[model samples]
Each structure stands twice: as structure tokens, then as C-alpha cells.
Target: MSQGYAIELYFDPALENQVLKAWNVLARRQISTQLIEIEARPHITLLSSPSLEPLKLEGVVRAFAARQEPVPLSFFAVGSFPVDNNVLFLAPKANMALLQLHSQLCDAMRKEGVDVGEEFRPESWTPYCTVAQDVPKTRMAEGFCVLRDLKLPVTGYGVDIGLVEFPPVREVFSYVLGNPVEG
Candidate 1:
């Protein structure tokens, strides 16, 4: 375990269940079960850094969350990062609202003297919700085939934000951005 934290945007319950179905399917097939093993929630990470101190970060997040409203999300495609370790993800359409929320959260974290990761910077971010990670190159093709048949264009609202720690994944705190209307 390491002292790391991330700011995560989570969708409403129904959307979360839909995503969970994919996670469960992948886990059962023995493709990649790292996420479920670690017990991570379905979320888009806004910013993450091991240097972040939770005490200071929580206030900024609570205040920021209070000021924001539900973020509309559309997961239009399955995506992945090009690295040997690999990551399979759900790609949310980077609409104006989602971009602004990401920007504001980054700025807030910075103002609180938190060191934000450069890759999470607004201009650099590629808003995605991870599905499976640490998948072997040999099996990635199978992972894709599994997910491709699942679905795309999942629409929902990002209703909550949280501060989380990893290596078994613990949620320090979470707040509802606003009242999200369930579809």
C-alpha cells in the first residue's frame, strides 16, 4: 500500500450497475480482475497524485462539489492506453460541461497547495473510466472482443465525487455534486 489519492467522478447507481456488469464479466472470464480484486468503483479520475494530503484535499473537494451540478456523461466507446502494462476503459465524450468540471477541480486542488499530475491537466486529460487493467498483450484482443459485444454510448449523470486511496481502494469521503435525475 502507498499513500496516494485520487479525485473520482462517479455516475448514478443505474449507470454504475451497467458498468459493473462488464467488470463482472471480465472477472469471470479470467481476462483481468485487478480492479474488482482491488474493489474500485466505476469512476472517471479527475486528478491523482501520491503527494496529495487528504486532510487538505477534502475541504476543497467538498466546497467544489457543492458549487457544481450534475455532469452529463456519454460513454461512446471503449478505449485503451498504449503501454505494455495496458488499460481498458470506457471513454466518455468530452463535452463542455465535463471539461469545465475537470478544469475547476484541477484549479481547486492546485490552489489548496496540492500537487496535481500533469497528465490530469485539462489540456492533457482524456476522460476515461477504466474497465480492466494489467491485461496481457496476448489477451487484449479477447478483452476487446468481450467488451465490443457489450455496448457503447452509455448515457448518464456523474452524480458524485470522492477522495480515494488505493491498494485495496478506500474511500475517504464523497459528496453529491447536486441532485441528479435518474434515467
Candidate 2:
């Protein structure tokens, strides 16, 4: 069977910690069958496609790294996809550079014959940091109660990107594509 791969924009560890902290608080108050533990690195998915050869992946990452410059992003309010009632997320304040990067990445992936979901396409997208998934309605309400009262911190410059692999039946492995940001 073919493996699954996801090209995602990972948050620096500091920002990830904050998101985890919030998620932990919500998990404690919820009773849901969904996976509540925060395992994968916090990220805003750029694209997820079928597994590609290592060389192809390297080329894709290199191309993205070369064309895309780092940009600043801020986290704002908390929101939910009411229909799914399965995700609780932190919103990102509007940033044109981020949007443009998203668009460019999608375009690049398409040129390579990758099918990025129409629902996740640029124009209709709302950038967010997902905190929890598969949350039960009651728990979701409780999570909202807590998230609504809290103030989430924004990562001033979250420009790092990463490539992650999720095998058909194994743990996910992630690799950072660039150097760690200098303090």
C-alpha cells in the first residue's frame, strides 16, 4: 500500500507549547472518543498529497523554500466548524503574505499533479491553529467556554516549514526543512 504524506507549515516549538497547553485544558474537561492527545507538531497544513519519491519531496521542499520568504502571523479568536463539531481552532489575523504563500504553494503542488482539496483552496480558506479534533458536542461547548475566556498568544514570526509522513499503518515522522530561527 502507498504511504500518505503531508507538506505542512510547522510552528516553532514555543508557539506549539502554547497551543498544547490550551488543548490539554480542554481535554481534561471533555469526554469524547476522538484522539485528544496532542502528538503531531502544531501546523497550518499547506498541502497533503500522496507519498512522493524522496528526491521529488526534496525538490518540492527546495522549491518552496526558495520562492517563499518568511512572514509574520498572529493568532486571534477561537472558532469552530459547526457542521463537523469536531475541531476547535485558534484563528490567525489576516495577513496577505500568508495568504499569498498558501496560494502559491497550492499552485505549485497542482503543477506537480497533486490534488489539494477544493475546500482547502486559497480563496475560501480561513487560517487557523487546530487545538483539538473529534470533540464531542458537550465537550466542544466546554472547550469553547474555556477558549472564549482565554487569550491565546501569537507567534510573531512563524515562518518555518516542514515535511511530514504518515505511513499507512505507522507513526508519523516530521522533518524541518530549514534552520531553526535565530533568537
lDDT of candidate model 2 versus the reference: 0.67
Each candidate's lDDT (Cα)? 0.88, 0.67
The prediction achieving the highest TM-score against the true structure is: 1
Tens-digit lDDT track of model 1 for 59-173: 7788788889999999989888988778998898999999999999988878887767779988898899999999988889899888888767788999999989876699989
lDDT, model 1: 0.88
Q: Total clashes, candidate 2?
A: 0
Misplaced by over 4 Å in model 2 are 1-4, 31-38, 50-55, 167-183
lDDT of 2 at 131: 78
What TM-score do all the candidates reach, one by one? Answer: 0.94, 0.78
Report lDDT (Cα) of residue 175, candidate 2.
Answer: 40
What is the Å distance of residue 57 in model 1 from its true position? 1.7
| Model 1: how far residue 35 lies from native, Å | 0.9
**Regions more than 4 Å wrong, model 1:** 179-183
